[model samples]
Target: MGMKYSDGFSKQLPTLATVGAALVSLYLMSQAMKSIPVGTAYSIWTGIGALGVATLGIFLFGDRASAPRLACIGLIVAGVIGL
Candidate 1:
């Protein structure tokens, strides 16, 4: 019973972490954007979040790095950097 509960929680950890990170990020970014622009704020937020998720997927989930996956991840990284 304890093992099952722990397993379930473990399964949900990454999703929960992403949500938590996004919430924190949005609030912080909003504050920074108050004196700036929405377009800029959204660009930064989405690009950074995409890069973060891809990194987490690779590091935590033992995800594959096939050619297509690598290409997509590269695009995301470029977006983050370009932003």
Candidate 2:
């Protein structure tokens, strides 16, 4: 019974995470769009999301931290800053 509960909880984790992310993203985007160009806001939002996911993958999921990957991440941040 304990194993079944744990398995069910694990299965729901992704769904919960997705919903939480979406809600926060929507709220942030709406707030940002009020003061910035939609294109700029969206670009920055996506850039931040990509960088965050990459960092999490590297630290939590043991993703490869290759030079090219790090360089690309830097480029993304630079692009966001350029905006």
Candidate 3:
């Protein structure tokens, strides 16, 4: 949605915000790595991100929530929990 904004100030603000968010996410992951194994932390981080984005796409962007897609999301949740 932010990326859909026109060029100039509008685009710059969203871009900056995105960069800031990515930086913060990395920082948090690094902090988590202090106690959790790197591989486990990274997997869980990516899995949760994927699940969140997919869920948001369904509710916010009217993306299809088909049975297969939902199953895949469930699998992601299971994998994250397994790790």
Candidate 4:
């Protein structure tokens, strides 16, 4: 009777875990913001998120990066570093 609802309820775990991780995320984000302008925070956050997703994709899916991908990753790193 509850088979279909099981998947819906199970999704809460990831959602709650994300909320917890978000707290930790903001800590590093705060560190990233040190001496960085408020506007740059958006850039730094974007770079971090993109880099993490790309890295995870490579690790979990065995995705290969072309030269352009490497360059884009480099750019993201530089953006974070400069922030």
Candidate 5:
């Protein structure tokens, strides 16, 4: 979203994509909250999103991969599972 807004002319496509992603995220969160505690649902959602984004960054964007980063992702997964 920040990236989309950083464009001086307000890039419509990036803005729309960001908005769409946010809406879908909210809808999924609402649905998940129906069966899970709000904290648990939110944490799980955040963990998954973070891990996914990090993985994509490493694979597609050439973000440097490090052992600590992988360990942290594992920890996030464990925490989510523990919830």
Candidate 6:
């Protein structure tokens, strides 16, 4: 959504913020690897990311939240918890 802004500053700010957020997330994930297994940590990280983005898309962009879509999200949550 921020990427769709017409002004240059608005567009660039969101892009920069996204880069900073990603860096922080990666750093935290790397730190978690000290205790958690590599495969499990990676799986949980990706699963949480996917679930967060999907859920936000529904609220922020008015993306569809149909039953099947929700069920898939539930599956991702379950997988993350199982890990």
Write down the lDDT of every candidate, Cα atoms only: 0.71, 0.83, 0.86, 0.74, 0.82, 0.86
- Measured against the true structure, the TM-scores of the candidates, in listed sequence, are 0.62, 0.81, 0.85, 0.64, 0.82, 0.87
Enumerate residue pairs that collide in model 6: none
- In model 1, pairs of residues that clash are none
How does residue 29 of candidate 2 score in lDDT? 98
In angstroms, how far off is 7's CA in candidate 2? 10
Name model 4 segments beyond 4 Å from true: 1-10, 27-35
Query: Mind giving the per-residue lDDT tens digits that candidate 5 earns over 1-83?
Result: 33435375388777777778889999999999999899999989998888888887888778888999989989988987898
Off by over 4 Å in 6: 1-10
Which prediction has the highest TM-score against the true structure? 6
Order of all candidates by TM-score, from best down to worst? 6, 3, 5, 2, 4, 1
Clashing pairs in 5: none
- Per-residue error for 74 in candidate 2, Å, reads 0.5
Candidate 2, TM-score vs. the true structure?
0.81
- Give lDDT tens digits, candidate 2, residues 1-83: 22233465576766566667678889989999999999999999999988988888898768999999999999999999999
lDDT of each residue in 1-83, candidate 1, tens digit only: 22233465575766576567667877899897988688877887777766766677777777776889888878877876676
Cα lDDT of model 6 by residue, 3-35, tens digit:
434255456778787767778999999999999
Encode model 3's per-residue lDDT on 9-55: one tens digit a residue.
36778878767877898999999999999999999999988998899
Regions of model 2 farther than 4 Å from truth? 1-10
Q: What is the lDDT of residue 35 in candidate 3?
A: 100
Which residue runs of candidate 3 sit more than 4 Å off their true CA positions? 1-10
Alpha-carbon runs more than 4 Å astray in model 5: 1-9
lDDT of 4 by residue, 1-83 (tens): 12222455476666566667777878877986787776788687878888987877777767897889889989989888986
